[model samples]
Target: MDGQWVEVADRVLVRRHAELDLSAGLVVGDGGCLVVDTRGDERQGAELAAEVRRITRAPWTVVITHSHFDHSFGTRSFLECPVWAHEDCRADLAENGAAARDTWARWYRERGDDGIADDIAATEIVLPDRLVTGVAELSVGGRRVVLSHFGPGHSGNDLVVHVPDAGVVFAGDLVENGAPPDYEDAHPLGWPPALDGLLGLLGPGDGTVVPGHGDPVDRGFVVAQRAEIAAVAELCREVAAGRMGLEEAVQLSPYPRETTVTALGRPLDGPPPAPGGREIMRARSWGCPG
Candidate 1:
C-alpha cells in the first residue's frame, strides 16, 4: 500500500503509509481538516500532504502525537499549517533533535543507504506553535476534536486525538498492532493508564482506533492490549519487590519480556541493580500489581 486511505467514519480518513505502514488520520470538518500525525521525513510528509489535497482542498492543522523522528520530524514539510503538540515534545526536539539525526544517519549508513540517512539529517525538527498541558479542544472544520495528554506512556510526552463525534481516536505510539510495543523510550509503569485514558475516551467498543503502527482496530483490541500491559506491569513489580529476579521476571512476562524488563530500569539478571533505585520502586508501587 503506497498509501491507502480507509474511510474510518463519516468524514475521517485513516491513511496508512506503504513504506513503513505507519498510520495517520485526516479529519474533515465543516471549515477544514485536522491531521493526526505526520510521516517520518520530508518526502513522506509531502506525499501525505498531497493525499490530503486530493481528498479535500481545505487548509490543514497538524497535531503531532509525540516527538519521535518518524512522527514529528516530518512537520517541517507541512510548515504552512499550524502545528500543535505537548510542551515536552517541543523541549525534546530542541534538545535531542541533532542527536536523533546523527543516530538515524548512522543507521542508514550501516544499511548502505547514505542518501536516506542524509535526508533524515537534513530534515528540520518543527516545534508545535500551540503547546498543550493536559487537554485542549479545537474546532476543525466545525467539528470539535479533543487533544488529551494521558500522562506519560509511550514516552514522557504523548498525545492522543479523540474525536467524540466520530468515535475515532488517533493513537500515536501508544498502541501497536504487530510485533511488540516499543518500550525503548516508554514509561512502562505509566503506559497502562495512558491506554486506560484512551479506552475511557472511546466510551465503548464501537469506534475505529487508528494506531501509530498497524491497521485500525476496535475497542476489543484495545481491551486485550490493556490486559497484556497489565501483565507486564505485574512482572515489573515482581522485579522491584525482589519477589522475582530480572531474568525471572522476564521469563514470566507475556509481552516482549526482555525489552519490557530492561525498559522498566531493572537489572538483566545477575548484574548489580540499576542506580535509579527509588524510581523503579516507585514505578512498581504505582503500577498494576495483578
Candidate 2:
C-alpha cells in the first residue's frame, strides 16, 4: 500500500506490502525516530522515506535487523542519517555484498525487469556507523529504545529493537509471517534460543511484535511459531542421526518441505523423482544428535 501507514500503536508506524513490511518508530521525548529496516532498493526506500516525512520531521536513526540484501542493502537511501546494525552485518556486506547484488540482479533480470536489476546493481552498500554486541540504548525524543543482539540464530548477526515503555518490539527477520522461515544462512541449532530471547525480552508477547515481514502479531503467535521451529530442529537432529530419512523428516516438517530441507544445512544425497524424495544430510557436523 503506497502512501499508506498502519499505526500499530501511538508510537509505531508500519508500511505494509505484499512481499514485506517496513516499520519506523517515533520517539516523542527527544523528537527523534528509529527506522527498523529499509526497503529492498533505492526506489522502495525512497518511498518509505516519503512516508516517514508525512509522520514526523524528527531526525532519524536506522537499525538494521540483519544484512540480507532486502533488509540492509537499501540503507544507502538513508545514509545521511545515523545507521546502526550488528557488527557481523557490516562484515557480511563487506565480504559478500557484491555477490548478493549480482545474485538478486540476475533474479530480477529473469523476471524481465532489467531496470529493477540495474537499480539494485547501482545501489551502494551502506554499513552501520554504530555497532552493538549484546545491547545498546538510546534516547529518541526522550523515549528509550533498546537495541539488543539476540545471538547467531537467523543469521550470524540479528538485532531486535525493544521499546519498553511503549511495549513494542521491532523483531527483524528473527520472525517471519505466513511464509516459511529462511534458514539458508541460519543456525538451525541456535534458532530456537533466539526466539527464547525474544520471548524473554518482550515478556511473553504481552507487547506488540513488529516482525521483519508480515503484519504485527502478538506473543501467542510467536509462541506457536516457536513450537513449529522446535519441531523443525528436532527433525534436523533426526536427519543428522540417521534415525529418519530426509523424506520422512520433510513430511513431518511444520514448514514447507523445501524450506525444511534447506534449513537442515545440507543437500540431498542423490536426486529424487520428486523434489522431496531423496535422503538429506548436513554438509558439516553441527554437533547435535536426535
Per lDDT, the best of the predicted structures is 1
lDDT per residue (tens digit) for residues 28-143 in model 2 = 34578888788667777776777787878888888888888777777877769888888988877787777777776666677677876787888788878899889999887778
Q: lDDT by residue for model 1 over 82-201, one digit each (tens)?
A: 899999888877877677767665655676766666777788778789999999999999999999998887777889999889899998878877546766566677889899999999
Q: Per-candidate TM vs. native?
A: 0.88, 0.87
Q: Tell me the RMSD of model 2 versus the true structure.
A: 7.5
lDDT of 2 at 279: 14
Stretches of model 2 off by over 4 angstroms after superposition: 1-3, 19-29, 266-290
Q: Candidate 1: which stretches are off by over 4 Å?
A: 266-290
TM-score of 2: 0.87
Error of 2 at 24 (Å): 5.7
